[model samples]
Target: MPIKSIKVRLGLLSIIVLTGTMKTLGQANDTLLIRQLAPVTVSATRLEINEKRLPAALTVLGGGRIQIGQPQLSLFESLGGVAGLFAQNPDNFSQDLRISIRGFGARAAFGIRGIRLVIDGIPESTPDGQADVDNLDMGAMRRLEVMRGPSSGLFGNAAGGILNFQTENANEMSLLEGQVTVGSYGLRSYRFKTGVQKKKFQYVFIATRNQSEGYRALSHMESTILNLKLRYDFDSLTRISILANYGNSPVADDPGGLTLQQATENRRQAHPNNMRFLAGESVAQGRVGITFEKTMGKHLIFARAFGTKRDFANYLAFQAAGAGTINRTFAGASFQYQFSQKFDLIGYRFRLGMDVESQGDTRRRFDNLIGERGKLTFDQLESFKNIAAYVTQELTYQKVTMLVGLRSDAIRLHATDYFLTDGDQSGKRQFSRLNPSVGISLEASSKVNIYTNLGTSFETPTMSELSNNPTGTGGFNPDLNPQQAVNYEIGAKTYFSQRLRTDVALFDVEVKDELVPYQITGQAGRVFYRNAGRSRRQGVELSLNAVLAKGLTLFSNYTYSDFRYREYQTTTGKFDGNVLPGIPKHAAQAELRYFTPVGIFAIAQVRHASLLYADDANAVTANGYTVVNLRVGGQKTWGRMHIEPFIGVNNLLDAAYFQNVQINASANRYFEPSQGRFWFGGVKVGIK
Candidate 1:
């Protein structure tokens, strides 16, 4: 269908919905019983806080809400409608989905940058607050909260924001849930979860196995994951929890970006001969934590401590049938204390926290020489440590609330180069920064609230930027300073008749000495890192949720952004004044759902994104595309068994488009295409 027709149809649908609201409401009330539900969130702070009352822009997705959407493949793709956030599926389910919050980390293909990710109060991101959630199982989650804007003063290095995932707990005695799905492309998946709770002791185990032939040729993947959680409460005020996860997956090679003509010619075929490449990743992680809470009359004290470790391995295939592997290890600890009413100040809350993290990575590059040829190998190692402390206070006076926070971070880094012609050597670098933030909330009325915030954040250079061998590219930079940014935001939240909720926010960020990676046209195009003179980013975000009469819900969001380099030199260091790459000028989403008797549900979603440049030089631009999706599902209960079957259609209109592009060394403009129209159906069953 043409874009014009799609828009016309959407308009017609909207008109029909509005015209028949009363009738539909009556039918919905008679056919399906529904009730008003309160919004749930946890990301505003470490504690459970009402989202409406929080002095920030927050988005929450409850477990039931997510499951109702019947997401077949990537969880990120399922959340494409969030304001100021974009989720892209480059190629079917073979690769990690690309997620960007306010265009902060769109460059990374396998991992997330400039954002902090946490699960069940344990930091899932690396020492610098970067994370990869490719292995996370959304089925076992209770809620997902997204906090946007500057948050370094609260979580440390979360320049963009934070994603907090809370897992389901065994609040009952025994429960067992499982799902088995089979769909197009030879896709098959199995998820099993079971938990037992007895008094103060509770345990839950989850396992998943998935395999797919993918929507494209040679794009096949197989992954297995296991998660275990155990919790014990020694007393009413003390608790201990332990969690572990292990995952492994083999991925197909990138088909390389395609042009418009190429995408139309062969939507299911990858680049010729690309099947010879093979790569995979594996992860092992675990965490142990304890919480203590005590109350004395008007005073309350809360404390927590946690230790975590993550191990990673990555293998890449290169030319001459040679291969290389990268290994990384991370360990961290955190401590926090919260004191309430310490001085009898009404509605006063104070919190202090500290964190320490150590990380190291080793890379081994090798080549397979021909017969009678000698094999060559080289190795490099890099290590880094980060320490941070923060303090926060919140005071509520009547309908006005104020929050103030301050944080300090210290970083130490070291690099050791071995197997080099110059012999073994070591280098060190250090950096520190202090950040502060303040926010205010005013309750304009019983159904409306206004909020404003001003905050500062800093981003430290990654180990890859500091110590990676630059011989092939431009050689590593031994001296790199942390980037600093100031963010300002204003927003308002309004609730209408307790049925409709809306939020609108405007924000701008200015960065000084921003680190940017660029390529130099000297000695085979070497890649190096440099700091941009300056940059500015501004945007507006709007989100709305409506619970219409009769088991119907509507959610919509839109964002408009203006990102550019304020002062940059193109000649001296290959940096020029240009629009930042990968950031869309405009994005929007709309979703509608209807619930019916017999436990049946139907949903439709539409998404749109504007054009964006592919490279820093602005020589190539990728055309934006709009997509539509549809889903239908039903559930039935039979005695001790319950079964739910769902079917979903993505890219319903089959609009062929590219998500990103870049100028590669081959002088070819490679583009990553969005997934074509695909269909999937699955069933989930539960046993008690």
Candidate 2:
């Protein structure tokens, strides 16, 4: 099938949607949160407040919208209509999902960086700001909240943004549900969920298995996951909750990135070297966390502790140090206290919190002898430890709210190289940083809020990045320095009516000593890091959520980003004024949802991305493209039993596009072609 490129008249569509919402009469705001009609509570900023009252840009998606007639593969499935957010590489199991918020995480080679991922008050991203979601049980996700812009003032280190997730809780008496799905390209999935609530004891258990031969050759992946949540309410103001999860992925293969010529010739074929080396990853991971909360008078206290262990192994495309294994263990704890008081018409809230975390890794590497490991090349023990404290104060008077926060972190990195033939590159380093932020929100009208914030972020290179050693030795990169960024943003939220709403924001970010990634010639999969002098990022975001008619709604967003290096100078050339690679200059998405009286529902989505560069020089570009997708489903209930069946078509227009681009890749290999016109369908049955 050949792909066709097209454009959408988004301005005209926006006008039509605005006109429809203007004529709707107030209907008591009793609609479900998924409709985006009711106000939502947001906790992504560490402060519980109304989404409309938060000074920062925030997006809250209810669980209902997240899983509606969709493949439970990635969070990108539900985040299409969000501004200033970009996600790609859903089919690349080795690299995981590549997500960037406001261009902060665009430098990542594998997994995510800069942004923080938190699930149920436990940090999913490590203290050094590295995250991998391959083991995450997305099937049990209940809610998602995204906070954009710098946020290190509250959440220490690499808090350029936040992704907060909540899993299903025992909200009802009992629930038992099962679902099985099969799709194109040998996709199979099975999921089961059960929950029960009795008095002060509640528990939720979820299990999922997903297997796929993938849309590309040598891209097979399979995983089995289990998640459990247990809670005991002691009292209304005092409670404790425990969460546990385990995941195993025995077969995950990497197709590897390809050049434009290679992708155009055959999009489904794996890289030749990747096939020869049997490139892929395998993992066994488990985690457990506990949380406690207590309230005394106008004061509240919260505590959390968690531990995790993972055994991982991977094979890369090259032979030198291509086979790698990691035995990793991590543990963390946090304590927080908040005080509130009211003085007539003025109110104040003070918060203080402390966190400590440690991670250790036993890493070893061997030569990849054409699908088999040969001799040991490198062996090392690496650890990262961090301790941090934060304090925040908030004051409310009349129609205005002001918040100020400060945080400081002490970080230490150590590595012990046991490969003595290499002269033993054992080393240690320490760093300390302090960040501060402030925000103000004004209620200009009952339906509008004007806000401004200035926030700062600090990011350290992950252990994997530090250990990549450009010299082909086994030690941390002594020259790689941490990056610091400051962001300023102003935004407005307007509720034209209960059926219509809009959010607009403008932001500017300045970075110093920005970390950059590049590849050496012989080491195909190895990524080496360097530092750029300075960089500047400016962007605008606009979003709209409108209930156009009774059962019809529209959610749309647009983003314009201009990111560039201001004073970057490398040994090769000066990169000043060059555009950042991997991120598009313009991106937009529009989604329409409709429901019929016959228990039928439909979702239509259109997304577009402007041309992007694959290298810092902007010499190589991937053409712009627009894609459409649709999902249709229906549900019915009969005698305590519920059933739903759905079908989805991605790339309905068969638009030619690249699903992922490897930035600054050597040998001009960057493009990862996307599948054209994929189909998926599934049925679910349950008793509640």
Global lDDT of each model?
0.67, 0.86
**Model 2 weakest lDDT span, ten residues long:** 1-10
- Residues 12-123 of candidate 2 have per-residue lDDT tens digits of 3223333332222123132642346566887787767778777889988877679878878777788776789998888887778888998888889988888999999999
Which parts of model 1 are misplaced by more than 4 Å? 1-41, 90-95, 172-174, 259-265, 272-317, 320-322, 342-345, 368-377, 473-476, 518-528, 572-577, 659-666
Residue range 149-240, candidate 1, lDDT tens digits: 87888877746787888777887312887877655566677888898888999998888887877667656777677778888877776677
- Window of ten residues with lowest summed lDDT in model 1: 519-528
For every candidate in turn, the CA RMSD to the true structure comes to 6.2, 5.7
Best candidate, lDDT-wise? 2
* Error in Å for residue 296 of model 1: 6.0
